[model samples]
Target: MSSETDSSLPTVAVFGLGIIGSRCADQLLNQGYHVKTWNRTPKERADSESDPISAAEGADYLAFYLKDGIALREVFSSIQNQLKPSQTVLNHSTVDLETTKWLAEQCEEIGCSFLDAPFTGSKVAAGQGALVYYVGGDSEVLESARQVLEITSKEIKPLGPVGSATVVKIATNLISASTVQALAEALAITNAYGIQPEVLTESVASNASGSVLASMKLPTMAIGDYDTHFSLENMLKDSRFALQLAGDAGLETPGIQATSAAMEAQCKKGHAHLDFSALFKAYDTA
Candidate 1:
């Protein structure tokens, strides 16, 4: 299960030089690993090496930070052959369970180890190397990737086999979406009564009902700054996936459906790039 072929630490090739991939690659480089990176958008190449196939050449770990399953599928065409049989591919994208499982099988076909290691936290955490990772794969494979994953994650929880990590990630998104919706509704109620947002936020922070969400987002709400940490569009996407999972399980999830609708409304209003706290804007404008 060891991805490294030699006595030395393995070289890593990261595909996608976006906020997440770039941060991961930088962390690997800082830890003294030879890191190679590539991005679909040529302009995204930030002085790091480029070319997906070239990056995979002789790499012991091939990590993907793709946006979704479709992007991952597309990228495979270019680098599938370059991936060595014993090398591991860590997929950090929040893709569906079925797709994750299929990707693992695909990697197995080529003699590569595949781990679904979807993450929570945003660009802020990525840059700070404080993201929380939920890993799913063979336990031995996970142990092999532990050192590298530890560099960029504050917590790395092994959830089970391939695709289980994605389930946990989607479940986490459900809670986050619901929390943001509840916070927005609560703030709107207070706003309707002419209560100061700062006072309400302070009281909530000091009360039993307060949460990490309130502590992290209240400052932005007080200043009416809805810049991105996690975007409404991304939240909506996650919500949809969560709801789909709920449906597959024959369970009810009206809250997720409601939150997904709200996010869609916000996105349609051209706030897609804004933080999920922008959900407040939908209520504020309504």
Candidate 2:
């Protein structure tokens, strides 16, 4: 285990060096924090010499952009013995509430703090340090992570304790998925009616019902550019997370269910690695 520094600057350990994780680490570095990072695969680590346990050793804050619940559990197990009392763990992964709460309880048992701080916005937002954070944790811990959160996020909104951030993240995913499906349907409808996609998008985007998603995706749809900023696989995972949350709450989410089906169809067509906006292809080709 690494030793904590006496310097006034905060020390952080970041796991999962994916697009978002890399951006967060970069932001922390810019803010003059000593950020140690790790990834599941050696090549995925920003610096291969840094192992997960060693990266987390002696860190004041442990941050993660985990791939899934299983990955988070694996990391927690690996570092369980090394974590110090009062050390804060910020989970930025979009996962189920049950899992988040379970992890928080586990951390609490070890005398550490856990915060569910899932994010909104994509690589672009992360690169610009303009992402939004939905924070769920004790008020004091949330406040303590505020400076570090501000380094990588433009806004951090507390939604209550423990599992609340996951709840909000699920809602956000539902809205995003719904928006993509809506855009796909609208573009397909306009094309069938012989109305140009550019024209329809322009008119709708200026109206109340138009969303940031519609505008952002319109240009790409017009030219059929569906490159990956956020992959369909990840979107599908989030949709599943949302559906699972609804099931746990004993609520029905018909729209999310429909969106999940559409996304699965796109995935079946082998577009899982493509941008989520590629869902448009399903409707466009029909």
TM-scores of the models, in the order given: 0.91, 0.93
Q: Which tens-of-lDDT digit does each residue in 1-286 have in candidate 2? A: 2233336778888888787888888777777777788887765444333567888877899999987788898888888888888699999988777779889888988999889999998888999889999988898998888988998999999998788888889888899988888888888888999998889889888888788888888778767898777888888998999988888779999999999998999899999988899989976663
- Where model 2 places Cα greater than 4 Å from the true spot, the runs are 1-7, 44-50
**Tens-digit lDDT track for model 1 on 1-286?**
1222333677888888776888877777766777778788774444355677877888788888887777888887677866678788999988777778778888988988888999987888888888898988889988989988887899998888887889999999899889888888888888889999888889999999798888787667657788787778878888888988999999999989998999999899999888898988876653
Query: How does each model score on lDDT?
Result: 0.82, 0.84
Each prediction's number of clashing residue pairs: 1, 0
lDDT of 1: 0.82
Candidate 1 is scored at a TM of 0.91
